[model samples]
Target: MSSTATTTEAAPTVELSTLPLRGGEKKAEEKAEEYKYAHLLPHFSEDRYPPLEPYKHIDPGHRALKHANPRAFLDSAERVVELTPHLGTDVKGINLANLDSDGRDQLALEVARRGLMVFRDQRDFIDRGPEFYKKWGQHFGRLHVHPTSGHPKGYPEIHLVYRDGNTSFNFEVDDSITTTVWHSDVSYELQPPGLTTFFLLASPPTGGDTLFTSQVSALKKLSPQFVAFLKTLKAIHSGVEQAEFSRAGRRGGIVRRDPVEHVHPVVRKHPVTGEEALYVNRQFTRRIVGLKREESEAILRLLYDHIDKSADNQARVKWEPNTIVLWDNRVTAHSANVDFRHLPDARHGARITPQAERPQPALEGLDLSA
Candidate 1:
């Protein structure tokens, strides 16, 4: 039940009407979010496209494969010669302009496909501190303002944390497997985050690492039968389900900024690639369409269990101070591990600025069932 503390007006709201859909026409889509067992597949045409379910689950999709190591495929001998860890991955200091335009685009595309990308031994950039976040972040997109407990400081662009005394968020928890749970940031809003960038200002001496998993990859891994089943449904996602404390003394105790609920396609298409992905996450996805309470619970439980059970499908990044991690919020889910307790408090070196996402309705011709 804490207030935003900052005096600045809340970040600009995300309105559905502002987004540019293919046609200027406005139409009411089906309100299937309440249905318990309704899936997405049977409702749409099957022949227009292949079941996107398979694409969501696969290890290497046809598109990702085509561009696999394009550095190897298209680069000259000099491009292959760079062996520095920072140069190899997505993080190349703050100046992306220094990179070859095509190479930079390819790396950004790779980051989009991989969900998360990292840079190591990043000292120069991290030392510059909070102000540094503003420079590169503004170039990316509109910086997000937290609807509620935004940041301790007035600056909406950053969330500052340090190991010493009373500063801001005391991000300390007394458990080792701290982040075994999965979550997407701020799903309570209509326009969920499109992307996120978090850099590690300080890291533990030993084991604190972050795990990233591709929701699209996980969805593609599901059995065709299950994918078909899920396609027929939409789920309700609300912050009220989690942040109970935020709703202290209200009628429903729901601290909702927008009274109207936002509904998204059960399966999402990549904004850039046009390839589809199964986009639900445990923290945000609440229930299935058309099914009764018990039925929806059963389906959700199975899915919740399945995502955790499938471990090989994920990637983990061990933290090093000054390491910057950027990810596409639409396609990935992240969790923090608490093994760093012995080292000291893990302070955020800079702020987390997430981009605004455009809401898109699922195209009518697509099929969820193969």
Candidate 2:
């Protein structure tokens, strides 16, 4: 049984009680990192949100439904536009908060196929507050508590996603873009997020859009021989970076959860759509198993480049103040545009990610016996 080697270096121990929930609260040093980039808005914050227990969410909900109809889901939508041929679909004139159970079920199936769903002017959803947003995610599946990110004071299910000029995450590139760390949310977990809903609270007038690329399209762009070879491999996804984020206390001080690692197939099959998608992301996928470091790096680089350059199948979402994007984390990779970081204004949003079933191999007709 071949496997990848896990990290052995000791990480510094930071007690949970000492962790501050927001910046401007306390700083251990003048240059401490914990008080950097933020996700929680100060007005909507509380002091401490407890950590999640070591638990697993087993779900066979929307993915197992056989009679879902995408057209029916869009019947109430005033305007339905596909942001890209393969990636994001914008459905206007619909309040997601009022979606019935059947509508929600059908919408979930469509999200799995479309990779991303966008709804603008979501005043109803926004006004309902964070608790309502958490409950909406709960309807899809078991809501995931982010392992090492900041949230509203009492809300752990809603992960705060925000950016401001005050944070150190801004770039100073001549090209207007220096880095694009594309990833699925928490792919290192045993059961990574399936359907994730991100509601935009605010955005700059000109920038702070999100770019999503289709992993299914990336997989299809590969040659048959290359994909066949990839099916025999699995990639290691680690939470080392996320743990470092907590240790550094990016949003004031967050409870430092121990990092985790999970192995997923290089090509994972969508539970509902049954389409194969390239599963390795630049953010968390560490290395491919049973290969030398250089060999794994080369192959992973090729795949990452393939996804990064897939502009035709990519979608750029220009966020409005009350926009909500629901996406399948298993089928798409997204990166935030931080171009507005030069402005004093902040781009803020809250996300509720529902963890789904484990990644399944796309191999159905391939050999079963080892």
Candidate 3:
């Protein structure tokens, strides 16, 4: 599991003539057979962020969590700790790429009330490269482009979290790493992200942590009559297992924008602290729309076992090697202990979500039958 020889380019080209593209962004030789091992995601031509043309994404919200400054954002925090009382905090002297725009609107309201923040000596904010990680996540909105993650070659908006994952297509001797699913990133996007960002390139020498929870504290430990029957139900977020794990090519073969589903609102309403969460996720939530498929798999397996057994609205982070986490893909639901990546020991990172709109409904027509 080792290789480092850069300078064998070719493969990625997108001349530009979009009238309707999206079959892997058209013409790498006309959908080049949906890329079968085309250097496992190698697309170039001095790409300045290529392969993104379809539009209609809209996140235009979170106006600095409504004019920032919660005491100059806790006086630019040089120590904040609150790793849980409903999700993480850990600040210690700000420098998230030198904020200030009212400290990035109070750091987006302290990541929408601590849905997870933590940031330690980010080696000078990742030595300021990768376009400052897509310019500090486009200052919070419209940066998401992960349809089977893998980036950092002309910055396809930097989203590549590989612990040998799809290492040029499944690098073997897979010992085991995957602490059972929990997600919120591509909520089967119709704009499904809200201020994410997890940069930690390479980490080990410890059990690789990362297991956040707190979907607004699992909707306040459920039962306001079962959260008004889960905000009048609706949940079917599917990118079809990222299009069958990138056409069964696993992780890196990317279909970019094909497998979509979007139904949302199994109680999700936090476009910047409108609160109310628990947006069903055992990875892309696939059920409970109008129930009855055995009641949507017994109410999505009892709300994914009440947000994976709340564990007092969990939080575990513990990463290093210039760490940095941001979290709050509209509430929280992460997972990846990678159990130290089967001791192959090399859990990489580079996420940069932003999208954030399209998923509201905290109770549109309330007055539940109680």
Q: Give the number of the best model, judged by TM-score.
A: 2
Q: What are the models' TM-scores?
A: 0.63, 0.82, 0.31
> Model 3 lDDT vs. the true structure?
0.63
lDDT tens digits, residues 271-346, model 3? 5567888788876788776557998898888888877777888887776556688877878887755554345433
What C-alpha RMSD separates each model from the true structure?
Answer: 15.5, 9.1, 18.6
Lowest lDDT 10-mer window, candidate 2?
A: 1-10
> Looking at candidate 2, what is the lDDT of residue 342?
70
lDDT of 3 at 227: 88
Which residues of candidate 1, in runs, are more than 4 Å off?
A: 1-107, 150-152, 160-178, 241-243, 246-261, 342-346, 349-351, 359-370
- lDDT per residue for candidate 1 within 1-370, as digits (tens), equals 0001111111111122211122211220232223221111011111112211111111112233356574432243222222222112344434332334344445445556666666544555545544655665554455555432323222545643323121223223335434466666665455666546666433334565667666676777888887776666666666654444434421112232422234555666666555556656676677665679999898778777766776755766656545666676667776656544343322333446545454343355433221
Candidate 2, pairs of clashing residues: 34-249, 46-153
TM-score for predicted model 1 compared with the true structure:
0.63
Better of 2 and 3 by TM-score: 2
Q: Order candidates by lDDT, high to low.
A: 2, 3, 1
Local distance difference test, each candidate: 0.47, 0.69, 0.63
